[model samples]
Target chain A: MAVAEIKIELKKGVADPEGQNTKKALELLGFEGLRSVRSMKCFQVDIGLEGDEALKACQDMCRRLLANPVIQSYSVELK
Target chain B: MAVAEIKIELKKGVADPEGQNTKKALELLGFEGLRSVRSMKCFQVDIGLEGDEALKACQDMCRRLLANPVIQSYSVELK
Candidate 1:
Protein backbone atom coordinates (compact mmCIF):
# COMPACT_ATOMS: atom_id res chain seq x y z
CA MET A 1 0.00 0.00 0.00
CA ALA A 2 1.08 3.57 -0.54
CA VAL A 3 0.34 6.54 1.69
CA ALA A 4 0.75 10.07 0.43
CA GLU A 5 0.47 13.14 2.62
CA ILE A 6 -0.20 16.36 0.74
CA LYS A 7 -0.12 19.83 2.22
CA ILE A 8 -1.41 22.88 0.38
CA GLU A 9 -1.16 26.53 1.30
CA LEU A 10 -1.56 29.91 -0.34
CA LYS A 11 1.38 31.21 -2.32
CA LYS A 12 3.65 33.37 -0.18
CA GLY A 13 2.69 36.47 -2.08
CA VAL A 14 -0.99 36.01 -1.43
CA ALA A 15 -2.75 37.56 1.50
CA ASP A 16 -4.65 35.19 3.76
CA PRO A 17 -7.38 36.71 5.85
CA GLU A 18 -8.05 33.38 7.47
CA GLY A 19 -4.49 33.14 8.67
CA GLN A 20 -4.56 36.72 9.93
CA ASN A 21 -7.74 36.11 11.85
CA THR A 22 -6.26 33.00 13.36
CA LYS A 23 -3.27 34.96 14.56
CA LYS A 24 -5.48 37.61 16.08
CA ALA A 25 -7.59 34.98 17.77
CA LEU A 26 -4.55 33.28 19.20
CA GLU A 27 -3.40 36.50 20.73
CA LEU A 28 -6.79 37.13 22.26
CA LEU A 29 -6.71 33.65 23.73
CA GLY A 30 -3.60 34.40 25.76
CA PHE A 31 -0.92 32.99 23.49
CA GLU A 32 1.46 35.87 23.49
CA GLY A 33 4.82 36.19 21.82
CA LEU A 34 3.46 34.59 18.70
CA ARG A 35 5.25 35.80 15.65
CA SER A 36 3.53 34.30 12.63
CA VAL A 37 0.62 32.25 11.41
CA ARG A 38 -0.49 30.48 8.24
CA SER A 39 -3.34 28.37 6.96
CA MET A 40 -2.83 25.03 5.26
CA LYS A 41 -4.76 22.05 4.00
CA CYS A 42 -3.63 18.48 4.40
CA PHE A 43 -4.69 15.22 2.81
CA GLN A 44 -3.68 11.69 3.57
CA VAL A 45 -4.25 9.10 0.87
CA ASP A 46 -3.81 5.36 0.95
CA ILE A 47 -2.97 3.89 -2.40
CA GLY A 48 -3.47 0.23 -3.04
CA LEU A 49 -0.14 -0.27 -4.73
CA GLU A 50 3.50 -0.48 -3.75
CA GLY A 51 6.81 1.25 -4.57
CA ASP A 52 7.40 3.25 -7.74
CA GLU A 53 3.96 2.75 -9.19
CA ALA A 54 2.30 4.43 -6.25
CA LEU A 55 4.70 7.34 -6.25
CA LYS A 56 4.11 7.96 -9.93
CA ALA A 57 0.36 8.00 -9.49
CA CYS A 58 0.56 10.48 -6.60
CA GLN A 59 2.69 12.89 -8.62
CA ASP A 60 0.29 12.68 -11.51
CA MET A 61 -2.69 13.37 -9.28
CA CYS A 62 -0.96 16.34 -7.73
CA ARG A 63 -0.23 17.73 -11.15
CA ARG A 64 -3.53 16.94 -12.78
CA LEU A 65 -6.09 17.20 -9.99
CA LEU A 66 -5.10 17.56 -6.34
CA ALA A 67 -3.49 20.96 -6.84
CA ASN A 68 -3.24 23.74 -9.35
CA PRO A 69 0.41 24.24 -10.13
CA VAL A 70 -0.20 27.93 -10.68
CA ILE A 71 -1.40 28.61 -7.14
CA GLN A 72 -0.56 25.65 -4.95
CA SER A 73 2.42 23.41 -4.21
CA TYR A 74 2.38 19.93 -2.69
CA SER A 75 4.97 17.61 -1.23
CA VAL A 76 4.39 13.86 -1.27
CA GLU A 77 5.66 11.39 1.26
CA LEU A 78 5.20 7.73 0.46
CA LYS A 79 5.31 4.94 2.95
CA MET B 1 -1.74 34.30 25.23
CA ALA B 2 -4.21 31.75 24.01
CA VAL B 3 -3.60 29.47 21.09
CA ALA B 4 -6.62 27.77 19.65
CA GLU B 5 -6.15 24.72 17.52
CA ILE B 6 -9.09 24.29 15.25
CA LYS B 7 -9.76 21.23 13.14
CA ILE B 8 -12.56 21.38 10.64
CA GLU B 9 -13.98 18.40 8.79
CA LEU B 10 -17.16 17.78 6.92
CA LYS B 11 -19.83 16.50 9.25
CA LYS B 12 -19.85 12.70 9.35
CA GLY B 13 -23.11 12.59 7.45
CA VAL B 14 -21.66 14.60 4.61
CA ALA B 15 -19.89 12.93 1.73
CA ASP B 16 -16.41 14.24 1.04
CA PRO B 17 -15.55 13.97 -2.63
CA GLU B 18 -12.11 15.50 -2.21
CA GLY B 19 -11.21 12.91 0.40
CA GLN B 20 -12.38 10.09 -1.79
CA ASN B 21 -10.30 11.31 -4.69
CA THR B 22 -7.26 11.58 -2.47
CA LYS B 23 -7.68 7.99 -1.37
CA LYS B 24 -7.87 6.86 -4.97
CA ALA B 25 -4.82 8.87 -5.89
CA LEU B 26 -2.86 7.40 -3.01
CA GLU B 27 -3.63 3.85 -4.09
CA LEU B 28 -2.31 4.73 -7.50
CA LEU B 29 0.83 6.05 -5.76
CA GLY B 30 1.82 2.65 -4.27
CA PHE B 31 1.01 3.14 -0.57
CA GLU B 32 -0.45 -0.19 0.39
CA GLY B 33 -1.88 -1.34 3.73
CA LEU B 34 -3.50 1.99 4.27
CA ARG B 35 -6.83 1.61 5.93
CA SER B 36 -8.18 5.11 6.04
CA VAL B 37 -7.51 8.51 4.55
CA ARG B 38 -8.93 11.94 5.27
CA SER B 39 -8.49 15.56 4.26
CA MET B 40 -8.13 18.35 6.77
CA LYS B 41 -7.18 22.00 7.07
CA CYS B 42 -4.72 23.27 9.66
CA PHE B 43 -3.90 26.70 10.98
CA GLN B 44 -1.13 27.86 13.28
CA VAL B 45 -1.22 31.27 14.87
CA ASP B 46 1.03 33.14 17.19
CA ILE B 47 -0.92 35.52 19.35
CA GLY B 48 0.90 38.74 20.17
CA LEU B 49 -0.09 38.99 23.80
CA GLU B 50 0.09 36.94 26.97
CA GLY B 51 -2.09 35.36 29.69
CA ASP B 52 -5.89 35.46 29.99
CA GLU B 53 -6.31 38.19 27.46
CA ALA B 54 -4.98 36.00 24.69
CA LEU B 55 -7.13 32.98 25.51
CA LYS B 56 -10.37 34.87 25.53
CA ALA B 57 -9.63 36.50 22.20
CA CYS B 58 -8.89 33.20 20.55
CA GLN B 59 -12.19 31.69 21.66
CA ASP B 60 -14.10 34.74 20.54
CA MET B 61 -12.43 34.60 17.15
CA CYS B 62 -13.27 30.95 16.76
CA ARG B 63 -16.87 31.57 17.63
CA ARG B 64 -17.32 34.81 15.75
CA LEU B 65 -15.26 34.22 12.63
CA LEU B 66 -12.67 31.48 12.36
CA ALA B 67 -15.12 28.57 12.31
CA ASN B 68 -18.77 27.96 11.99
CA PRO B 69 -19.74 26.34 15.26
CA VAL B 70 -22.39 24.40 13.41
CA ILE B 71 -19.80 22.61 11.28
CA GLN B 72 -16.50 22.81 13.11
CA SER B 73 -14.89 22.16 16.51
CA TYR B 74 -11.75 23.57 18.11
CA SER B 75 -9.39 23.15 21.07
CA VAL B 76 -7.29 25.78 22.79
CA GLU B 77 -4.02 25.76 24.67
CA LEU B 78 -2.25 28.49 26.60
CA LYS B 79 1.37 29.12 27.42
Candidate 2:
Protein backbone atom coordinates (compact mmCIF):
# COMPACT_ATOMS: atom_id res chain seq x y z
CA MET A 1 0.00 0.00 0.00
CA ALA A 2 0.94 3.61 -0.53
CA VAL A 3 0.18 6.44 1.80
CA ALA A 4 0.22 10.07 0.76
CA GLU A 5 0.37 12.98 3.15
CA ILE A 6 -0.85 16.19 1.61
CA LYS A 7 -0.52 19.64 3.11
CA ILE A 8 -2.50 22.49 1.65
CA GLU A 9 -1.75 26.04 2.71
CA LEU A 10 -2.46 29.54 1.54
CA LYS A 11 0.00 31.24 -0.71
CA LYS A 12 2.23 34.01 0.56
CA GLY A 13 0.44 37.34 0.95
CA VAL A 14 -2.88 35.55 1.20
CA ALA A 15 -4.93 36.68 4.17
CA ASP A 16 -5.47 33.94 6.74
CA PRO A 17 -8.31 34.89 9.00
CA GLU A 18 -8.22 31.72 11.02
CA GLY A 19 -4.55 32.18 11.69
CA GLN A 20 -5.08 35.80 12.64
CA ASN A 21 -7.88 34.82 14.94
CA THR A 22 -5.78 32.22 16.59
CA LYS A 23 -2.98 34.65 17.19
CA LYS A 24 -5.37 37.07 18.80
CA ALA A 25 -6.87 34.40 20.93
CA LEU A 26 -3.45 33.27 22.08
CA GLU A 27 -2.53 36.77 23.05
CA LEU A 28 -5.74 37.18 24.98
CA LEU A 29 -5.00 33.94 26.75
CA GLY A 30 -1.62 35.39 27.88
CA PHE A 31 0.68 33.45 25.59
CA GLU A 32 3.66 35.72 25.12
CA GLY A 33 6.11 36.63 22.40
CA LEU A 34 4.13 35.11 19.57
CA ARG A 35 5.54 36.13 16.25
CA SER A 36 2.95 34.64 13.90
CA VAL A 37 0.63 31.75 13.38
CA ARG A 38 -0.44 30.08 10.17
CA SER A 39 -3.25 27.60 9.85
CA MET A 40 -3.72 25.18 6.96
CA LYS A 41 -5.27 21.92 5.89
CA CYS A 42 -3.87 18.40 5.91
CA PHE A 43 -5.10 15.27 4.20
CA GLN A 44 -3.75 11.75 4.37
CA VAL A 45 -4.87 9.34 1.70
CA ASP A 46 -4.13 5.64 1.86
CA ILE A 47 -4.13 4.01 -1.54
CA GLY A 48 -4.31 0.34 -2.26
CA LEU A 49 -1.35 0.60 -4.62
CA GLU A 50 2.26 1.65 -4.67
CA GLY A 51 5.00 3.78 -6.27
CA ASP A 52 4.67 6.59 -8.78
CA GLU A 53 1.14 5.58 -9.66
CA ALA A 54 -0.02 6.43 -6.14
CA LEU A 55 1.89 9.69 -6.23
CA LYS A 56 0.32 10.64 -9.51
CA ALA A 57 -3.16 9.83 -8.28
CA CYS A 58 -2.65 12.03 -5.21
CA GLN A 59 -1.39 14.95 -7.30
CA ASP A 60 -4.41 14.66 -9.56
CA MET A 61 -6.68 14.56 -6.56
CA CYS A 62 -5.13 17.76 -5.23
CA ARG A 63 -5.44 19.57 -8.51
CA ARG A 64 -9.03 18.50 -8.94
CA LEU A 65 -10.49 18.85 -5.46
CA LEU A 66 -8.03 19.07 -2.59
CA ALA A 67 -6.80 22.59 -3.25
CA ASN A 68 -7.66 25.81 -4.98
CA PRO A 69 -4.53 26.57 -6.96
CA VAL A 70 -5.38 30.22 -7.32
CA ILE A 71 -5.11 31.00 -3.63
CA GLN A 72 -3.48 27.96 -2.09
CA SER A 73 -0.48 25.71 -2.63
CA TYR A 74 -0.04 22.05 -1.72
CA SER A 75 2.71 19.50 -1.23
CA VAL A 76 2.40 15.71 -1.28
CA GLU A 77 4.70 13.18 0.34
CA LEU A 78 4.22 9.51 -0.55
CA LYS A 79 5.23 6.61 1.69
CA MET B 1 13.20 31.84 18.13
CA ALA B 2 11.18 28.70 18.01
CA VAL B 3 8.87 27.30 15.41
CA ALA B 4 6.20 24.86 16.43
CA GLU B 5 4.30 22.75 13.95
CA ILE B 6 1.00 21.58 15.32
CA LYS B 7 -1.12 18.95 13.70
CA ILE B 8 -4.67 18.37 14.91
CA GLU B 9 -6.45 15.31 13.67
CA LEU B 10 -9.64 13.45 14.37
CA LYS B 11 -9.18 10.53 16.69
CA LYS B 12 -9.93 7.07 15.39
CA GLY B 13 -13.70 6.36 15.44
CA VAL B 14 -14.42 10.06 15.05
CA ALA B 15 -16.54 10.88 12.00
CA ASP B 16 -14.60 12.71 9.30
CA PRO B 17 -17.01 14.25 6.87
CA GLU B 18 -14.37 16.12 4.93
CA GLY B 19 -12.28 13.04 4.41
CA GLN B 20 -15.27 10.99 3.46
CA ASN B 21 -16.33 13.61 0.96
CA THR B 22 -12.87 13.80 -0.53
CA LYS B 23 -12.75 10.02 -0.96
CA LYS B 24 -16.10 9.98 -2.69
CA ALA B 25 -15.12 12.80 -4.97
CA LEU B 26 -11.89 11.08 -5.91
CA GLU B 27 -13.80 7.93 -6.78
CA LEU B 28 -16.26 9.89 -8.85
CA LEU B 29 -13.37 11.47 -10.67
CA GLY B 30 -12.17 7.96 -11.52
CA PHE B 31 -9.15 7.76 -9.25
CA GLU B 32 -8.85 4.16 -8.20
CA GLY B 33 -7.41 2.15 -5.33
CA LEU B 34 -8.19 4.64 -2.63
CA ARG B 35 -8.39 2.80 0.68
CA SER B 36 -9.04 5.63 3.10
CA VAL B 37 -8.72 9.38 3.52
CA ARG B 38 -8.21 11.41 6.69
CA SER B 39 -8.26 15.17 7.04
CA MET B 40 -6.70 17.42 9.65
CA LYS B 41 -5.66 20.92 10.68
CA CYS B 42 -2.08 22.17 10.66
CA PHE B 43 -0.78 25.20 12.46
CA GLN B 44 2.67 26.72 12.32
CA VAL B 45 3.38 29.13 15.11
CA ASP B 46 6.47 31.22 15.54
CA ILE B 47 7.39 32.07 19.09
CA GLY B 48 10.08 34.38 20.40
CA LEU B 49 11.51 31.70 22.63
CA GLU B 50 13.43 28.48 22.29
CA GLY B 51 13.88 24.92 23.53
CA ASP B 52 11.80 23.40 26.27
CA GLU B 53 10.10 26.66 27.09
CA ALA B 54 8.81 26.98 23.55
CA LEU B 55 7.71 23.38 23.51
CA LYS B 56 5.82 23.84 26.73
CA ALA B 57 4.13 26.98 25.49
CA CYS B 58 3.00 25.20 22.37
CA GLN B 59 1.59 22.30 24.33
CA ASP B 60 -0.31 24.78 26.42
CA MET B 61 -1.60 26.48 23.31
CA CYS B 62 -2.85 23.20 21.94
CA ARG B 63 -4.59 22.30 25.12
CA ARG B 64 -6.11 25.74 25.50
CA LEU B 65 -7.12 26.55 21.94
CA LEU B 66 -5.64 24.59 19.06
CA ALA B 67 -7.43 21.30 19.75
CA ASN B 68 -10.45 19.89 21.44
CA PRO B 69 -9.65 17.17 23.92
CA VAL B 70 -12.79 15.16 23.28
CA ILE B 71 -12.73 14.07 19.64
CA GLN B 72 -9.47 15.48 18.28
CA SER B 73 -5.88 14.75 19.16
CA TYR B 74 -2.91 17.04 18.53
CA SER B 75 0.83 16.75 18.29
CA VAL B 76 3.37 19.54 18.38
CA GLU B 77 6.85 19.46 16.94
CA LEU B 78 9.16 22.29 17.90
CA LYS B 79 12.27 23.48 16.19
Best by TM-score: 2
Which residue ranges in model 2 land beyond 4 Å of their true spot? Answer: none
lDDT for model 1, please.
0.67
Error of 1 at A30 (Å): 2.0
**DockQ of candidate 2 relative to the true structure:** 0.87
Query: Which ranges in model 1 have alpha carbons more than 4 Å from their true place?
Result: B1-18, B21-37, B44-79
Query: lDDT of model 1 at residue B1?
Result: 42
lDDT per residue as tens, model 2, B38-61: 999999999898999998899899
**What are the candidates' interface root-mean-square deviations?**
4.2, 1.0
Return the lDDT, model 2, position A52.
90
Candidate 1, after superposition: displacement of residue B68 in Å? 9.3
Which window of ten consecutive residues has the lowest lDDT sum in model 1 chain B?
B1-10
Model 1, B45-69: lDDT tens digits are 5667566776666666567756666
